[model samples]
Target: MQLFTGLALGSVFVLLAVGLSLIFGLLTVVNFAHGAFYMLGAYAGVFFIGYLGNFWLTLAVVPFAVGAVGLGVERWLVRPLYGRGIDYPLMLTFGLAYILVEVVRILFGAEGMPFDAPDALMGAVNIGVGYFPAYRLFVIAATAVLVIAIWLFLEKTSYGLVIRAGARDSEIVRVLGIDISQVWLLVFGLGTAVAGLAGVLSAPMRSVFPDMGTTVLVEAFVVTVVGGMGSLAGAVVAGLLVGIVVSMTSLFAPAMAEVSMFALMALVLLVRPQGLFGKKGLMG
Candidate 1:
C-alpha cells in the first residue's frame, strides 16, 4: 500500500518534472513559474467543476487555459530576454512566481480550499496487500496514458522532429526556414500545460491553496537534479525513486521523509554528478 502510494505521488512529480525538463531543453529557460501555473490549474479545475459539474471536462479544459496564459507569458515576457544571459530570465521567472502566488492569495485568501474526488473515484480498491484509494490508481493510470501519449508525440510526429532538432541547434533549424520562435512559444506552452494538468489531477489529493505550489516546486527541482537536468527519461526515473524513498521513510521515520530525498540527491551528486540519465556537459 505504501509503495503504491509512493508511485502515485511520484507520477505527479513525473508530470511536473518532465514539463520543467522539456522547457529547459528546448527554450533554455528555468521556469520558476511552472509551479504557479500548476496552482492556477487547480483553481481553474475548481471553477470548471463548480460550473460544468464534470471532472473529465475540467481535466481536459484547464490545461489549455493555463497553456494559453503560458503562451502569452513566453511571447511577451520571456521572449525579450533571449540573448541577455541566463540570469535575466531566471530572475524574471522567479519574480513572476512570487507575483502569481501573491495574486492568487489576494483573490482566494490564504486558507486552503477543500476539493473532493468525484463520486466514482471515492472508494478504495483491494489490491491484495490492502485497500487503497481508487482515485490514486486512477491517477496512476491517467498519468501513464498521458506520459505515453507525450512520448509518442515527441517520437513519431513531424513536429516532434522539429522540436528535437531545434533543441539540438535552434540556429540551424532557423537557417532551414523554420520559425524557431514559434517553436519556443509552443514548447513553453506545452510545458506549462502539462504542469497545469498535474495540478488538476493532484487537487483532490490535498488542500488547494495559493502557496501549495512551493513545496511541489522544490520537490520537482530535486527530481530534475537527481534525474539529470533537461533529461525527460531521467525525470521519470528519478521521480519514482524519490517518491518511493520518501514514502517508505515516512513509515519508519516520518521526520526523515523530506531529508531522505535531499540526502539521496547529495549522494547521487557525489557518485554520479551527471545524474541517472544526464549527459555530461548539459548543465541545463
Candidate 2:
C-alpha cells in the first residue's frame, strides 16, 4: 500500500518534472515559474469545477488555459530574452514565479483548501491483498496514459519530429528553412500543459493551496536532475525511484524522506552528471 501510495505521488512528479525537462531540453529555458503555472492550473480547476461541475471538462479546460498562458508568456516575456545570456531567461522566470506566488497569496490565504475527489473516483479498490484508493489508482493510470500520449506525440508526429530535430541542432533546424521558433513556442506550450495536467491530477492527493507548488517545485527539480535535466524517460524512472525511496524511508526515518531525494541527486551527480539517458555535457 505504501508503495502504491508512493507511485501515486510519483506520477505527479513525472507529469510535472518531464514538462520542466522538455521545455529546458528544447528551448533552453529554465522557467522557474513552471511550478507557479502548475499552481495556477489547480486554481483554474477549482474555479472551473465550480461552473462546469465536470471533472473531465476541468481536466481538459485547465490544460488549455495554462497552455495559452504559456504561449502568452513565451511570446511576451520570454521571447525578448532569447539569444541573450541564459541569466536573462533565468531572472525573468524567477521574477515571474515570485509575482505569481504573491498574487495567489493575495487572493487566497496561506491555509490550504480541500479539493474533493470526483464522484467516480471516490472509493477504494482491492489490488491483490491490499486496498488502494481508487482515486490514487486513477491518478496512476491517467498519468501513464498522458505520458504515453506525449511520448507518442514526441516520437511519432511530424511536429514532434521537427521538435526532435530542433533539439538535436537548432542551427541545422534553422538552416532547414523551418521556423524552429514556432516549434519552440509549441513545445513550450506543450510543456506548460503537462504542468497544468499535473496540477489537476494532484489536486485530489494534496491540498489545493495557492503556494502548494512551492514545495513541489523542489521535489520536481530533484526528479528533473536525477532523471537528467532534459531527458523525459530519465524523469519518469527517477520520479518512480524517488517516490519509492521516499515512501519506504519515511516509514523508518521521516526526516530523511525529502533528504533522500537530495542524496540521490548528489550520488547521481557524482557518478553520472548528465543523468540517466542524458547526453554528456547537456547542462553545459
Candidate 3:
C-alpha cells in the first residue's frame, strides 16, 4: 500500500519536474513561477468544479487556461529579458511567484479547502498486495499515459524535432529560418500547462490553498536536481525513487518522512553529482 502511495505521489512529482526540466533545458530560464502556475491549477479546479461540476471536463480545460496565462507571461514579461543574463529572468519569476500566490490568497483567502474526489473514484481497489484508493491508481495510469505521449511527441513529431533542435542550439535553428521565438513561447506554455495539470490532479488529494505550491515546488526541484538538472528521463526516475523513499520512510518513521527525500538527494549528489541520468558537463 505504501509503495502504491509512493508511486502516486511520485507521479505528481514527475509532472512538475518534467515541466521544470523542459523549461530550463530549452529556454535556459529558471522558472520560479512554475509553482504559482501549479497553485492556479488547484484554485482553478475549485472554481471549475463549482461551475462545470465535472471532474473530467475540468481536467481537460484547466491546462489550456493556465497555459494561456503562461503564454501571456512569456510574451509580455519574460520575452524582453531573454538576453539580459539568466539572473534577470530568474528574479522576475521569483517575484512573479510571490505575486501570483498573493493574488490567489486575496481572492480565495488563506484558509485551506477540501476538494473531494469524484464519486466514481472515491473507493479502494484490490491490487494484489492490498486494497488501495482507486483514485491513486488512476493517477499512476494517467501519468504513465501522459509521459508516454510526451515521449512520442518529442521523438516522432516534426514540432518535437524543432524543439529538440532548439534545445541543442537555438542560434542554428534560427539560422535555418525557424522562428525559435515561437518555439520558446510554446515550450514555456507547455511547461506551465503540465504544472497546472499536476495541480488539478493534486487538488483532491489534499486541501486546496494558496500556499500549497510552495512545498511541492521545493520537492519538485529536489526531484529535478537529484535526477540531474535538465534531464527529463532523470526527473522521471528520481521522482519515483524519491516518492517511494519518502512514503516508505513515513511508514516506519513518520517524523522523518518530509526530510527523507532530501537526505536521499544529498546522498545521490555525493555519489553521482550528475544524477542518475544526467550528462557530464551539462551546466558546468
Candidate 4:
C-alpha cells in the first residue's frame, strides 16, 4: 500500500520535474515561476470545476490556459533576458514567483481551499497487497500515459526534432534556418503546461493555497537535480526514486521522511555529481 502511494506521489513529481527539465534543457531558463503556474492550475481547476461542473473538461482546459499564460510570460518577460546570462532570468522568475503568490493570496484569500476528488474516484480498491485509493491509481496511470505522449512527441515529431536539436546546439539549429526563438517559446509553454497538469492532479490530494507551490517547487528541484539537470529520462527515474524513498521513510521514521530525500541527493551528488543519467559538462 505504501509502495502504491509512493508511486502516486512519484507521478506528480514526474509531471513537475519533466517540465522543469524540458524548460531548462531548451530555454536554458530555470523557471522559478513553475510552482506558481502549478498553483494557477489548481485554482483554475477549482473555478472550472464549479463553472463547468465537469472534472474531465477542467483537466483538458486548464493546461492550455496556463500554457498560454506561459507563452505570454516567455515573450514579454523571459525572452528579453536571453543572451543576458542565466542569472537574469533566474532572478526575474524568483521575483515573479513571489508576485504570483501574492496575487493569488489577494484573490483567493490565505486560507487553504478544499478540493475533493471527483465522484468516480472517491473510493479505494484492493491491489492484491492492500487497498489503495482509486484516484492514486489514476494518477499513476495518467502520468505514465502523459510521459509516453511527451516522449513520442519529442522522439517522433518534426517539432520535437527541432527541440532536441535546439537543446544540443541552438546556434547550429538557427544557422540551419530554423526559428529557434519560436521553439524556445513553445518549450516554455509546454513545460508550464505539464506543471499545470500536475497541479490540477494534485489539488484533490492536498489543500489549495497561495504558498502551496513553495514546498513542491523545492521537491521538484531536488528531483531535477537528482535525476540530472535537463535530463527528461533522469527526471522520470529520480522522481519515482525520491517518491518511494520519502514515502517508505515516513512509514518508519516520520521525522526523517523529508530528510531522506535530501540525503539520497547528497549521496548521488557525491558520487556521480552529474546524476544517474546526466552527461559531463551538463552541470555547472
- Model 3: residues >4 Å from true position, as ranges? none
Candidate-wise lDDT, in order: 0.91, 0.88, 0.91, 0.92
lDDT of 4 by residue, 15-110 (tens): 999999999977778999989999989988888888999999999999998899899999999999998988899999999999989998998899
**Residues 1-284, candidate 1, lDDT per residue (tens digit)?**
89999999899999899999999877779889988998998988988898999998889999999999999999999999997877888899999999999998888888988878899999999999999999999998988898888889889999999999999998999999999999999999999999999999999996699988989999998999999988888988998899899999999999999999999899999988989888888753
Q: How close is candidate 2 to the true structure, as a TM-score?
A: 0.96
Candidate 3's C-alpha lDDT?
0.91
- Model 4: residues >4 Å from true position, as ranges? none
Q: What is the TM-score of each predicted model, taking all chains together? A: 0.98, 0.96, 0.98, 0.98
Shift of residue 195 alpha carbon in model 2, Å: 0.6
- Model 1: ten consecutive residues of lowest lDDT: 275-284
The C-alpha RMSD in Å for every predicted model, in order, reads: 1.0, 1.3, 1.0, 0.9
User: Which tens-of-lDDT digit does each residue in 1-284 have in candidate 2?
Assistant: 88998898889889889899989988888888888999988888888888899988999999999899999899889988888977899899888988988887788666777788899888899999698999999989988998899899999998899999998898998998999889989989989988988998898788698778888888888999889888889989999888888888798899898898899889998998888767887756
Off by over 4 Å in 2: none
Q: Which ranges in model 1 have alpha carbons more than 4 Å from their true place?
A: none
